[model samples]
Target chain A: METYIFYGIAIIALLVSFQKNRAKTRSALKKAWKSFENILPQLLTMVLLIGTLLVFADTALISKIVGKDSGWLGVLLAALIGSVTMIPPFVAFPTAAMLLRAGAGYMQIGAFVSTLMMVGVVTMPVEIQYFGKKLTFLRNLLAFVFSFAVAWVIQGVVG
Target chain B: MKKGKMILKRYRFALITMAAVGVLLLLQPQIGMKAIQNSTFQLQQMFFVIPPIFLLLGLLDVWVPKTTMVKYMGEGSGIKGILLSFLIGSAAAGPLYGAFPVAAVFMKKGIKFSNLMIFIGAWSTMKIPMFLFEMGSLGVKFALTRLAVDIPGILMIANTLQKMLTAKEVEEIYQKAETLLD
Candidate 1:
């Protein structure tokens, strides 16, 4: 799995760094912990918000909102839902396919998947901590608008 | 008491949400329990996925000189820098939020603004593992079409975002980054 690969690389790198200079390796670990702790507060809030959002926007409700023949309005709804909720791609893609099978249109799925990846309503607090307000706002807004274009293209090609 | 107050100040939002969850549990136990389970799953994923990323980031910070990073991803690195940004971003694992910390480091290292945006765009949508999952689940056409549009879109968005920022603002952001990850 990808997780193993990441851990593998990290551990090997850590060992090499340790062998080269103990002080440098220790500094690296210290830096890593500092960065992690820096974001922990926002991360916890984001996680809790995502959980609550997911509970309200379950599969059935999502499918109902974006079902086939739901039209452009459905695409909008799909994009909004995607923007607000944070689901891992491993879970999201399969759920999207299931939604498709459950009468969700290709355009709707396109918008959902696009915005789901690009826009992070819940993660904005953490994003603000790094990039500040204007950049984060513009990026998410541009991405949200771009999701519609993505939906249109997918509809033309795959729908 | 002062330390406790500082902790509360930092975690005010989380504490509010926890209190909200308590209210939800009282009103609708089933939904509250589901929310708790979902939050636990997310927390587990974060614990599993984040440590290694931070470790690698730390190593990157210590080992990779700023000049080296600037040489590859800095202002004049051009097409090569853009391509490298996309490659690094797409090859990465974990959620979009995970990419932000790495991005902070990249900014601190003096990566070009547009290249940084491209990296973020790639991390958000063009990840190879996610693309493969999309192909399997949604069909090759769906996956390819998204990629086809997304590649160009990423470039356009990055450029546009870079343009939208004033030079002074960009400098300020980079200056903020210099201290942020520390």
Candidate 2:
């Protein structure tokens, strides 16, 4: 079902892109390739980092930090770690799924995934380069706090 | 020295590739080969999947002119504009970086900074396609809960940031972009 939905959206997007006479599909493709090229180094680094983390970090290690019984301290710690770690959302979801299967709590997964996407401690340098330092810091700080709020809300709703 | 410079320029790509290999080997020689093989395969799959999507996105962006965007999302465009930007951004298919070019174009056309923040925040955090994926993998309740929490969180953060910066400051930034473009 999910695969079907994804393909459907992809098809629709392709059709939309092809609709207009002015659309420069070839140039757009070149630009997209260039974007990928620009990020290749960073992406390679991230893949290695994530691969290392998955290999070394086990359920026991994760549970010690974000186990269900660890309470708000665990939540805060998870949020902090997530804020500092930048993972693509596509990767983060499967990781959270794996952790959940390994006995991590919903709240912890929620906090981590939310912070992973929203907070940018790791990407702060890049973000600051793009958006000024002050704005970047404030955004990351607020996002870190809000990630915890998201976890708390999820706990309330799901628990 | 001129010959050296030419070689350096030509071999830059090879140098980076060799450095990446060296670092991987140095870190964990035992697993490095296996890791590289796996990562390469994964990267190949990602490239095949992601590039076309990004191309489609870029083409859609070009097709939808700046005038159309600004008409709906410009300064004092109000709640309607904010909502429209949010919906468009959340539905748009691509990474957060993809939003930058679109937002830059909108900013050039007088879209408010606060709303751009909202658009970007929601673009990354509140993607509907991502939500559907989550729903299928997780559950509808979980997806809905996340959507509920994230929507307001994105807005509130953007609003707070807006309060921190003055309208004049934002206008100044936009003017700078315009000047640079000119």
Give the top-scoring candidate (DockQ). Answer: 1
Task: List lDDT for all candidates, in order.
Answer: 0.85, 0.68
Candidate 2 runs further than 4 Å off? A8-56, A129-131, B1-67, B136-139, B179-182
* Fraction of the native A-B contacts that model 1 recovers: 0.79
- After aligning candidate 1 to the native by TM-score, how far in Å is the CA of A45 from where it should be? 19
Taking all chains together, each candidate's TM-score versus the true structure is 0.65, 0.69
Give the best candidate by TM-score: 2
Per-residue C-alpha lDDT of model 1 across residues B1-182, encoded as one tens digit per residue: 99999999999988999899889989999999988987787677657756776787777768765344445998899899999899778866568999998898899788999999999999999987577657756878999999999999999999899899999988988889889877
Runs off by more than 4 Å, candidate 1: A1-64, B1-70
Tens-place lDDT digits, model 1, residues A1-159: 556777888899999999999999999999989867766777777767767767887767655778667789999999999999987775577567656765688999999999999999999999998898999999999999999999999999998
Q: Relative to the unseen true structure, what is the C-alpha lDDT of residue B146 in candidate 2, on a scale of 0 to 100? A: 85
Which ten-residue region of model 2 chain B has the weakest summed lDDT? B48-57
Tens-digit lDDT track for model 2 on A1-159? 444555567667666555644347556556656655654555555555444454456568767778777788888878887877766654565456556655677788788878877776766665554456667778778888898888998888874
